[model samples]
Target chain A: MKFSIQKDRFAQSVQDVLKAISSRTTIPILTGIKIDVTEEGIKLTGSDSDISIESFIPQEEEGKILAEIEQPGSIVLNARFFNEIVKKLPLDRIEIEVMNSFQTVIRSGQSEFNLNGLDPEEYPHLPQIEEREVFKMPTDLLKTIIRQTVFAVSASETRPILTGVNWRMEDGRLVCIATDSHRLAMRKAAVETDSDAEYNVVIPGKSLNELSKILDDTKEPVEIVITDSQVLFRAKHLLFYSRLLEGNYPDTSRLIPTESKTKLELNTKEFLQAIDRASLLAREERNNVVKLSVIDQDTIEISSNSPEIGKVTEQVKSRSVEGDELRISFSAKYMMDALKALDGTEINVQFTGAMKPFIIRPEQDDSTLQLILPVRTY
Target chain B: MKFSIQKDRFAQSVQDVLKAISSRTTIPILTGIKIDVTEEGIKLTGSDSDISIESFIPQEEEGKILAEIEQPGSIVLNARFFNEIVKKLPLDRIEIEVMNSFQTVIRSGQSEFNLNGLDPEEYPHLPQIEEREVFKMPTDLLKTIIRQTVFAVSASETRPILTGVNWRMEDGRLVCIATDSHRLAMRKAAVETDSDAEYNVVIPGKSLNELSKILDDTKEPVEIVITDSQVLFRAKHLLFYSRLLEGNYPDTSRLIPTESKTKLELNTKEFLQAIDRASLLAREERNNVVKLSVIDQDTIEISSNSPEIGKVTEQVKSRSVEGDELRISFSAKYMMDALKALDGTEINVQFTGAMKPFIIRPEQDDSTLQLILPVRTY
Candidate 1:
């Protein structure tokens, strides 16, 4: 392929595709980024078997000639070294041309780089799925759905299915849930989709995180296509595909508490600060457990103790409390994560008992909820 | 000990002393910070054997009560955890009191921390240095002196003295030199010092780097005290002590050439950028060598070629070049370091021959110089 493209446009497209580049050298061809030039634009593709990212750079943008194609062909180049050279090239525009043997030549300003390129036929092809089960959602909503639940997924590979976030659609509402068995996060939103379509899929949390990073924060709509095993998200000039995790996701509906005996409404900021200070001491302990004690009708105490290090106690006032005097211990990290996922100024936490799991939800909205199992502290 | 101190003041002092705390558990006592309180104020000290730092919180400052000592005593606390606790505490003023048997209670706002403290008598005492051989220099100058030469020190400990920066005082001028055998950096400055007492001492590059970080970017003077085996720097309420490296440093005077066969002057920024681009291709090679060829009086070519990674060629313009057509190869990293150390916009590079070492200095002033040995490339 012979082409000349502007440096910045090419750099951005390369970066988008590089998100899927395989860092492992076990599969030699997978470590390369495949480039194809056509009359319309240049397409860049990178895949690591689990996820694939494809970005296209158009020929013209804002009356500037971004790329001029002489011949349409394909070649795969090393992703890392190619990206570094393109970033450091000291010119506004770059010229790239490939020889008959797939030797690539990149020229900018007074600097020129010639690299050995591999045949595009050696690279793995991306599976193409028919766009029958497709839906549209706002980019911001999709990113939020991914961020709120991805962190709760089990990072350990013991239960491969638990390492993925479960997504289910019913009655035009999309629900995303993830749990590592210790804590759980759930978010629900109304995505624009056909009423007849009902879908359930589990995508690896690590892939979702990478996809979220590549998603731009814009008001544009993102089109998602789901197959039997692969899901694709297309936004602007970028296409992201992730493989679905196998096996059934455990029923999380029964994990959330339906009722509580004690409830407290507190300002999220004040509660977060109190927990942060209490966590300072708890983090020194092995289990990172902090206790919460509710007293009278207006005061809540957060405390943590480590026998070898120290103990810290903090008092935080609540907006309203209608609960029996109680003391409960739970993972400080879990409480901090649940608080961060919430966006409301005031949050309501419901407690069943010292041993039973507790629920945290926004005071004004119940669409999002977090549940944490309290640790038994003797 | 009992005292109340402003949170900001206490936090700053704690941070300063925490720098000396060792993260390694090899020296258990070095992991803790020693605290001493008297009628005057409170002193915090942290030592890791190689370096010691002490920061004092005065009884009053700017007509405001920074600290009030109710009783005089001493104790030691774990530095890392204590610094984190103090930084996260939610109060403008904090009160700390020592209970029976070294238990310390730290209270601020509605939060309280009860930390286990160690008896201060077990902490190592800092060696007292006589102030007879002393001098003073602005903190900024001292920091600059350290930065310009520290990078050239040999990181390998094969030759102990090569890992340190050689500092010498002669004829009221302080000269600092660091060489890793491949490259050398020398900087000299006139400072007010004891003319009768000419001194030579080698300090470890790591210690100088830490000292430079602790010095503020103000014009305040820092007192320097030199002893038989240690050096002390006092600035404001902070005291920094570093152990001197023992051993005879190699004589580097004969390594620098006094005469040159060719000279070239170019803009430092442009030359550095050209070398940076050229190095991108050479980075994959074993030695990362970039070659410079002076073809004429106005233009110079910088190039690097790797058998597997291709070649890069960049042409840089020069203000003046009166050299014989010469081609020399050297490490891109060493050249970049020399360019970064140049204090002037234009730099003059003097080349003695193809294989001899070259000198790089500012065109206006030559007090500071950098030398790089050319690689023998067949």
Candidate 2:
């Protein structure tokens, strides 16, 4: 491959693809990034079996020439070193040339680099998924959905299916859910699709985490194509593919309590801060558990006690409190994560009892809900 | 003990002292910070055997009450948890009360914490250093000197004395030197001493690093007292004491050459960037070696070749070049460190020969100099 391209453009593309390249890959070739030059543009691909990322730089962008092709060829370079060199190159334009035996030379300004390139033919081929069920949504909305639910996914691999976020589409509405048995998060949004056929898939939480980082905050649309075993997210000049988990996701709709004997509405920031301070002492203990007890109609006490370290109690004013008095204990980390994901100034928390799971939702909307199972404390 | 202090002032004092409290210490009481409430003010001390730091919060400053002492007493609280609690407390004023059996209750606004405190009598006493020979220098200057020389200290424990920075004073001038045998950094400054006595001491590099972080960038003078076993630094409201390394420091004066066969003056930033880029490829090799050769009277080439990965060559322009043409190879990391230590826009590099150590000094002054030994490349 012989082509000259703008250094900044190439560096950005290389960085985007690098997210999928892991250093500990079992397949040696997976550690390398494949670079293919065609008549239209140049494509870079990086994969780690679980996820594959491809970024393309067109020959011309906005009437300005970004790259000029001298010959069409392909080669694989060590992703780690290649990305480092590209980022540190001290020039605007970089020229890359491939010689016999796949010896690649990169030149920019007065600096030049010659790297040993592997045969691109040994690289794994991108899985082909027929575009039968493709849906489009604003990039901002997709990013928000991923952020709101992905953190609640089970980090433990005991239940492999729970390590992914389950996505279900029905009647043009899409719902995403993630739960670790002790805590659950769900978000619902509307998407545009040509077919009314319903579908369900579980995408590894790690894939969603990486995808969210690469997604920009622009209002542009992103096309998602789902198949039985793979999924693809397509944006401008970028293609992200992730393998689908091969198990049925557990039904979580029945886990959230529909009615509660006690309800409280409080300022999100104030409640989060109180829990955060209480966690300072609770974190030293085994379970990182914090307790909340209703003091009066308008006040609640958040506290945690460690036998050896210390005990902390914080009183936060609630906007409104109703129903019976109650005290409950739960993981401070789970509560903080749930509060952070909710949008708005106020949050409504519902409790069925001290021992049962409770639900938390933004006071302004009901499209998202977080449920946490309370810990039994003597 | 009972006192109400401004939260921000108390938090800053706690943070400053906590740096000396290490969790791995064998002395159990050393993990706690000693808090002594006196009629005049409150003092907080934290120690880990090798170093001790104390910060004082005066009762009143400029007619403003920073703290009000209700009674006089002392106790020790766990440094790790106390610092975290103080930082996250949600109030402007904090009240700390030591109850029966050293149970400390800290109250701020609607929040309260009761922590287990250790007996103040069990905490190790701070070493007393007689004010026999005290010197004064600008805090900013002291911080700069430490930063410019401390990084060259040997990290390997093979020669324990090399892990410290040697401080020597003679004829009203103070010199600090640090070397790992392969590279050396030296900085000199003038200070006012109470007597014309010469002294030398080696302070651990880790202690200096922590002390430098707490020093403010002000023109106010800092008093330093040196003794046979320990050195003490006194600032406005802070006292830092560090134990001296007990060994003789090697003389490094003979290592620097008096004359050079080749002399080059170049912009410090440009030359550093070129070396940084060259190191990108060289770092993959075993030794991280980069070669520099004089191409002409006013230009030089910086390059690195990794037989398995690639080769990179960069040509950087020089302001002036004199003496014989030479090519030398050295550790890119050492060269980068030496270049970063220089303080001016331009730097003067002097090389005795291809195989001898080179000296790099700021073009504007001789207050600081860095010496790097070249690697013998085959």
> Which 10 residues in a row give candidate 1 chain A its minimum summed lDDT?
A279-288
List, residue by residue over B1-378, the lDDT tens digit for candidate 1.
888888888898889888777798597778898999998899999999889999988898778778878888888988888898889888888988989888999999999999999888899999788758778889998888888899999999989899999989888788899999999999998877754578899988988988888889988998888877998999999999999999888999999999988899999999999898888878866478999999788999999988776777888899989857789999999999989977889999999998999999998886899999999998
Local lDDT at B95 for model 2: 97
**Residue pairs in clash, model 1:** none
DockQ of 1: 0.76
B307-373, model 2: which lDDT tens digit per residue? 8887888898999999999999999999999888778999999999989999999987988999999
Give the local distance difference test score of model 1: 0.89
Clashing pairs in 2: none
Candidate 2 TM-score, true structure as reference: 0.98
Every model's TM-score: 0.97, 0.98
Docking class of 2: high
Off by over 4 Å in 1: A62-64
